[model samples]
Target: MNPSASQNIRPETVAKVRTGIPGFDSISEGGLPRARATLIAGTAGSAKTVFAVHYLAAGITQADEPGVFVTFEDSVADVRKNMLGFGWDIARWEKEGKWAFVDAAPDAEGPIAIVGDYDLGGLLARIEHAVKKIGAKRVSLDSLNALFVQFKDHAMLRAELFRITSTLKRMGVTVVFTGERIDEYGDVTRHGIEEFVADNVVILRNSLEEERRRRTVEILKMRGTTHQRGEFPFTLSSREGIIVIPLSQIQLTQSSSTVRITSGVKELDRMCGGGFFRDSVILASGASGTGKTLLVTQFMSGGFKAKERSLLFAFEESKDQLFRNAAAWGMDFAGMEQKERLMVVNRYPHAMAMEDHLVEMQQIIDDFKPNRVAVDSLSALERVSSLRGFREFVISLTSTLKQKETAGLFTSTSPSLLGGTSVTEKHISTLTDSIILLRYVESFGTMRRALVVLKMRGSQHDDAIREYTIDGKGMHIGDRLSAITGVLSGHTTFEGE
Candidate 1:
């Protein structure tokens, strides 16, 4: 095909500020707008200041763009001290004349020249001096709340915000102004100072639920470029600085190795679509003695055999009891742990805070980069946290697993009281990507277990509920129980048709 007339016109690439957030620039379609003021608004402790400082740090280290950080929340020394977590030597950077820190409150007492008889000229002149001194290209005001303390009227604060942004933009200085957001899940705050003035708006929100807390960053608006619109999960570490884990971005490499994992039962793999999906989440639910733990052991060992790392988080069983019981079923978890491919985490339901568990889980993932993760039963986690918290926990777990492309096989013990269908089952079923129910069906005067697929998103499987059996070797799906009378009564009488 010949090049069209429009194709002949090549567009120039616009300059952007590299924000230093891992996987973030990709979400922004490159980076933040250049020479424009961007508002990073959030409540206290939401890491807004850290993000702003890290952005400036990236400008200094990656782009060689000198930066000026004007703080209202912390002193220059305190700012430097806090940045130590990122392994950034603020003193070294300052000494090199590539960065400058200014405390706004200290300079406010000076005899100042008011720009146009309304603006803060002293602050502007100080900023200009710092910019010219080090050829700084970027600036960040720690927070606008501190800047607003002097102003009693809302109208004046908004005007001043506009003037400051305009002055910085005119100087070709890309700036980030951190502000406090009072309202959540909405545009701007009550003051509306940042919502109207800045060229770009970025919101960082910390959503607290009964089970977990999530930190997210969203680009509300970017003036001249296309950006991703999603609440991307972000994390700040003592070493990694800031990173955003985007969910939809699939990092599939050029390889389809048909990565096989043992499904605890050899026959169960044949029943499933050739083993559980690599890096997928599997929900296994059943009544007691359905061999959920045994099946999980087999799955974990499969990962070990494949030389891929895996973790088993047991909420109900003690490590010793699990080893002893699983040994009887031919699962050698202790042996796998010795090989360093498998890790067994045993925690009581009431022992640890749910938040600490999340942090620990992430740390393990970061350290191991495991191919498989198993939570023996989420019901234990649910017991410790509130319903809202449990939802957040599920979201966090799913989000993390998806982002890392790690397979997670979890169990949720369904009470026999509710049978195969009930509100409790429905609640958990809605949260998982796939649901596999194991239940006891009374047939021929005997209690038998059955396996059924409640749902499997993005894949098709058998719809029939089949008979399942557990023996010394492990769990297996048997032929459907065909002969039974009054099976729903929790008791069965056999009769020929």
Candidate 2:
């Protein structure tokens, strides 16, 4: 047999170890550098310990890789019990020889001191024994600050820290060392040496903003690899260990569909040049009580009638309210839901952070895999997020929906009751593929609803402002209001008057 030339080719890539934390791998461009030491630093209650533990647990459960946790602050029993609270059965894993704990905490009654002549050889030996016993591929040294506190001399502390990190790297095990930040605003550790000695540095922060505590994670440095910059919001829960939401890292190059889908309303579809393109984003902006929610319901109901799956994410309206409102217009939302063709999810915007809301939405979309998705109002989401954050959210969300090839409709409340542009409208106009405007027009002394297709990319749309009515049969689009002049400016005068 002749030797193949492909057998000797070497990959020109740096090896990485998956942390298994949600969004963490994506932000890190893969994961932490393999067989390298990473320093996780943060202040009290910043979840440094939990993050390290989750990494070890994930390695064992998801990668089929054994791990060893060397704790200097918590005992083995304490660590196991605490992990159990997060539904991680570390004790069971230990029994199965898939995980092991090396307790390095000082005895409560014993005087603890690292004499100037002493080295970390004893600790190193213990770690080596545990790793060899379990054939561990991952390790975590919790609270390296605890060891620093025992040492009096700075030189000795730095030497010991460097020695520990170097030895762990030589052991060929991916390692994480937790350290307490000196202050809230700085990434330096208590001894200010851990950051310089480790191959990777991740800082977790829990700070007070607007009288509320927000948790964030940042990759301060990752040697030999590129990583996502800026701070990303993260959440910790009992069931889900750590979830990092990287808003800036969301890719915008989602695949778009050229196929057009119906708008459900025949006249409206005609105005939009047949229908909207599949995987396109449509922004329906209007004033309060201008039937924005009704339009969304119609869009969703249209999907249901076509036997296409739909998901409605209602922020301001309750599920019952949505059902009743749809029923008033002769649409059976509850029936559609019963048939599993529709999914209505109601959320209180103020109850959670904007990042958390986005994460939840992504999870639901992934699980339901709906053909059509609607967010009743983006104004509520805008209110929950800062201006910059809202813009980022909309871009990230619309891009994701397009990537999934799902048609998306987002409703926004205009500040003006009459025809006028809003800041939000201006910001999102460029991000969306189409824009539909609904306004209130006053003719003589009567108030009426008017609709217009302001912009539809790559398609011809009706330019005239048509009067619409929401009655028992839902929105009825009449002929263009040609007899009325200045309708867009709130006051409309009859053409011949």
Candidate 3:
């Protein structure tokens, strides 16, 4: 390898323009290609129009760049009204000259008659005028499939769209053309428009599995640029439009912090080698009546006692139930919340898809700026999600918690009363920094409870499976059960007489 030759070598890459939709840029490896036509294809009701509107909206609000939106399916008035829900004031942008709409949607005459020897000259002329009128740097021809309905010549339609795309690129305008996906996993373009014009292709899918709606976005191709490949889960938000969750693309470069925080129980803290790491994710797994929720309550109380704000997402219990449970444990959850030291959000396990729940949880975690976050029994969420969705949720939640450096304690419920692993634990056990297992032990016709620090990364922890009791004052940790074995396996055996 010659030094001079190595110095002259450069990576081949495409310059990108940020799309402004959240989470899209990270997977796109920056943004969409600049001065190129990218096809946004999706089925009906998959938020294709919203994605286009949000892209141009992002340019105007984020970069002060003007845009032209050519609607071929929905009317301009309808678009202005529909986008208001996402809080995009398209009307205001139009008045400010930051946006121009080429109303190409078919009226009673069917989309301007393909004007002048069937060449798309009239519509193309309108688009060119709108671009020059606003000095636009971005253009979106939404739902180009509608134009196919008006004009039956598939070969000619592709040629005309390509010509329009070429003209836009020559003007240095970054472009997005939305098309309809005939099937969720079908070909990229139904009319083969992308084959001629698109320098990049993006596909959006709203798939239904087990009666649950799961939305995803994939960068099928980026001609001159590199991008993370795969179908990343995404969801539509009322505030920000489409948000893609790049689960596999999230970098595993979180910094490890030596600082420890209490697990809210003193003996438990000592057992975990001082306490849980500040940026660590801890999983507490046990069966019903095993004090899993009690542990979550204590964890939050401990943070509140330390003058640190703690946030708890309760999927298995209501706010009132949690408050009552905390009160029974000699803790004041309501009082802590009153002082703003704690924020408890309770939601049903089946409320939304895994991605939607992830977005909401991240927003709350960021807004609260909590020092600790706890999810009461992730098994509740797991029961309602598919195996893949559950795993994605757990990984995403763990990554976000680590990135924010917020201590997270997630609880999981075991299926068996004695000894068994839950599906939730199997998916997230490796991602967590520590694992605390609570199990039931049968001793001479009596049922007893035990707790153990099963695994702790980066520090020494007590391996003893010690007996624990729950009374009015909360869990009391005791000496290790030395004479008994197999405490974790739930089938206890006496070692010596």
> Each candidate's TM vs. the true structure?
0.76, 0.91, 0.96
Candidate with top lDDT is 3
TM-score of 3: 0.96
Candidate with more favorable, higher TM-score: 2 or 3: 3
Better of 1 and 2 by lDDT: 2
Estimate the TM-score for candidate 1: 0.76
C-alpha local distance difference test of each model = 0.73, 0.84, 0.89
Residues 1-497 of candidate 2 have per-residue lDDT tens digits of 11321232554255778788888987887788888989999998999999999999989888899999999998888889988988899989999999988888877778664444877788888898999999999999898888777666668767877787787788898989899986778646887866457888899998876555678899989987778998887877666688887777776643356687877777888998888888888999999999989989999999988889999999989999999999999999989999999999999988887666776788889999999999988988877776766776788788779879999999998898877776678788888888898989887678888899988887778898899998997998998898888766665678778
| Model 1 weakest lDDT span, ten residues long | 1-10
Of the pair 1 and 3, which is ahead by TM-score?
3
Residue pairs whose backbone atoms clash in candidate 2: none
Cα RMSDs of all predictions? 5.6, 3.7, 3.2
1-497 per-residue lDDT for model 1 (tens digits): 22221232444244576676776786776677878888888877889888888888888888898899988768788899989878888789899999998777545465444444355666778887888898889999878887676545567768767777788888889889898887667657546766668888888988775545567788898986667897876777666577765544534232122454555566566666566666567788777777778778888877877788888888999999988887887778788888788888888867655544665677777787788899987877877876754555666676677667788888877666325443334565665656777767765366677776666555556666677776787677777556654433344556764
Evaluated with TM-score, which candidate comes out highest?
3
